[model samples]
Target: MSTSSVVTAPWRLLWRLGLRSSPLALAAPLVRTRPDPDLAPVALRAAGADVAAEPAALESAFPHATDRIVVLVPDTDEDESAWLRHLDQVGGTYASRLAALLDWTPVNVRVSPGEGTAVEVATTLQALVDGWPVPVRRIALIGHGRGGLVLRAACALRHQTPDAWHELVSDVVLLGTPHLAVPAGRTMVPLSRRVDEELAGIVTDDVVDVSAQPLPHARYALITPHTRLQQSRLGGLLGDVLWWRHRLPMRPRKARSLFPSATLHHVPTHEIGLVNHPDVHQAMLAWLA
Candidate 1:
């Protein structure tokens, strides 16, 4: 943490906590150098309403899949769009590119992951994988926002079953995932006020420490924005039930990997667009290659 960022963290927290009262907004734009977004003309649209459920296994599920698969885990948001469509919007494109690069087929979990804790999500993910009835030699996980945390937790959750799918994940890509709490000027996007209601309840005070018991046989690439840490600048400041916490504060803290050995890529974009940003996707493709 830089001296300026550390010194200013508490005040930033105050502004983030109080929402509108803090002078941090004007002052932040002044003191903190906001990175140039340099945004491409991308349609940053939200997904539409939900659709009826469909069969789990289609006739051509993973037709190009061999002994390898790349799974895209998207954050559970209010976007009621079909899971597959939303996944495509978020990281499915990168997944397809990655799959083509490595001769792996991209796929999503059998069902939309319902409500659960990280461990519960992990177990459910594994159960769904087990039921797939497909031969798998290796697995690669790429997740955005909270979905990244779920994927990390699943990787950490040891599997007792013989030759489990969890054991096959060789690579993990975390897009805009917070891995710490009350970060000191840690580069991250703040949780949207709305995400707190649905996501905050479960991820409260939870920490996915990559430092301890590092994921075995797995390489990690954490991609997040270089922008300021806080989000919800316009939303109401005061939240009920303490909604500010995350898996924890994540990013390059003090010019180093907050995730220790993991390679870090910083991009210029909003949290959601981390998956869409070219720097992020390019770094992802390079890392996997």
Candidate 2:
């Protein structure tokens, strides 16, 4: 362990103890809510819910038209309209910006809230790929949070049965995805086990062992935030402990061993929000390119 880890170990323990003393803290599971697969979008739509928009019309602005397509998947409980509005408001014309910066065509996939699971979302993506107007020779799958998990599931399905869409995937970019498992502090686990068996089960089945089962052939990139709120610091530390306990980072490393290459990037940002940062946009542009 590093010197900083050794120094913080005692502090982490104290924080865990303090957190355990609270009944409210102990009541809730440390894991994120299960994604609702029912909300998975049935079809791809323009960012503003313009079903009438043509893919060709959207791609017309690109100076250097290429067969490459970039698909954006939002987090759980989010869809394309909300994602696009947020990106435009904070990211400042991110789609157009990316189009202007790269040769690839950018589009957003609308996923339903509370009902989009990895497998279901993957099916939706596959359908999009099958029906795309152009012959998609290359694709870059960009997902945020749970959406990343969906992409992984899609890749896994493709791996099982090779198809045109699977063959075309050139890049998979995951932003702030907890690939190994969701980080619930060490202290919460014992409390959860003692209090609610159902919560404990959820933590074990859904949070603890959620792996991407990443494809060996595809290039992958994992991006995380370096800066988070102090309130979530203990949870982050405990999450790291869970990672250590399970030897989790090894999953990605193993995937990297099989692929052409894989890269991990940590962008400095507060909390789970990094999509709007100019640095993040630049890094993504560079990576996608």
Candidate 3:
């Protein structure tokens, strides 16, 4: 054998062996580790993500407690019961539980228009609070996504509407609501584009500058949930891009800036899903307690 061949033989063999042993080189990217069954999901809401879900009507919706009521706002692509879905599957609803704690009943606001107008929704809430035939004692509000904006609009009208909303709303909890401007959605899908348009319309018409404006007689809880990275279809290359694109503009600082009096709780997991999570329930209850 030549001198050079002999000298490189051992090195070549080691390199080949190393390739076979390395997980990244040849092995399939399977056997991904998953969390334990007991693992709880966590999330945070950023200010730039706007939800475009349609809200519901008042009388036909959830049961109401005239004396005491807890109102929950559903985020994008969700309804009034969005917060209750997880808890309902487990046992009861977080809203009802919270209402019970404060001797209140859960009430969700749904606008008359099927498509949902922000002004109408806010007006309805104000009317309810102001027009209650009986003497109402306690009222609490929990809003997810765009619901937060609507509630803020409702509360902003405390003086204009003659509703004791400012005085009645004892506690307010916001789940990842976008109280400020959301991004112009880059989603290429046609349906998603329509939703984005609707959201933009709401931002233009419904959004109020509640910056540094705290609701009167209300305790604020602003919870932010970090979103999980979705598995990418193009081997995660595109997936990572899309994930950051949606989440990058989301800033907890925006939420904090909007509600200075709010007690902020951030969960850097998958930004809250389309539905509510139980761990969030515990967190809100603990805060109130």
Model 2 agreement with the true structure over 38-114: per-residue lDDT tens digits: 53353355635533234455454333445777878776556664344446446554456667777677767655434
Which residue segments of model 1 deviate by more than 4 Å? 1-60, 78-92, 110-120, 127-134, 182-214, 229-258, 270-272
lDDT of 3 by residue, 1-289 (tens): 0111112232332242233455354222111234233421111111222222213223323235357767666653344545555554556567666766645556555322123344555555555655454556777788776567666655665455444456767788887664344343443433323332232222322234544266756898776532211222222321222222243445531112456678766543222232455566677667555
Best by lDDT: 2
- Residue runs of model 2 more than 4 Å from their true location after superposition: 1-42, 50-66, 81-94, 112-116, 159-163, 182-212, 227-262
lDDT of 1 by residue, 55-142 (tens): 2442134334466767776663312122333354565667556766767666653222333345654665565456444666787787
How many residue pairs clash per model? 5, 9, 15
Worst 10 residues of 1 by lDDT: 40-49
Residue 225 alpha-carbon offset, candidate 1, angstroms: 0.6
Error (Å) of candidate 2 at residue 133 is 2.0
Give the TM-score of each candidate: 0.55, 0.61, 0.54
TM-score of model 2 (CA atoms) = 0.61
- Name the weakest run of 10 consecutive residues (lDDT summed) in model 3: 39-48
